[model samples]
Target: MAENINSIKQKFIIRNKLGLHARPAAMFVKLANTFQSEVWVEFEDDEVNGKSIMGLMMLAAPSGSIIYVSAKGEDAEKALLALGNLVEGGFEEN
Candidate 1:
């Protein structure tokens, strides 16, 4: 039998006024790099490596856009939870 892998996926709405701009994208990439799981983010028809700043910027998601975040690896669940919180929390904006 093939070994089972942890794959977690969740959708989040961009809450920040600026959406996932440079600062937020950098923050997201930084967080993703700290995880052992492979992360991917999707917006509309565009999906990119969650750990790549350029890839994230390419999404060009605006505020109120829905995004799908997925992670496949041992820490997939934790990754999704943290990423979801980040999205929901408006990237910690006041």
Candidate 2:
């Protein structure tokens, strides 16, 4: 029988000076692609695929913006943790 792993979800706040700009958006997409799970990000009532640069850019999430993230698959937990850490780390641009 196949193993069952439910999706993992969490909330994060942008703490970087640039927030989720082009470069950081690229970073998020890159990281999202590294995992086997399907990742997504949400702002307010909108949600976007975590691996899509255009989707993330549309959010215009600036510094201190709160966002929600969810991942589902084999690496769901790791994906959530990594994405959360990436945001909390401020993209290391500052």
Task: Report lDDT (CA) for all predictions.
Answer: 0.93, 0.92
Write out the backbone clash pairs for model 1: none
lDDT of 1 by residue, 15-83 (tens): 999898998999899999989999999999999999999999999999999999999998899999988
**True lDDT of residue 5, candidate 1:** 84
- Cα lDDT for residue 1, candidate 2: 100
lDDT of 2 by residue, 15-51 (tens): 9998889988999999999999999999987899999
Give the best candidate by TM-score: 1
TM-scores, all models, native as reference: 0.96, 0.93
Clash tally for model 2: 0
lDDT of 2: 0.92
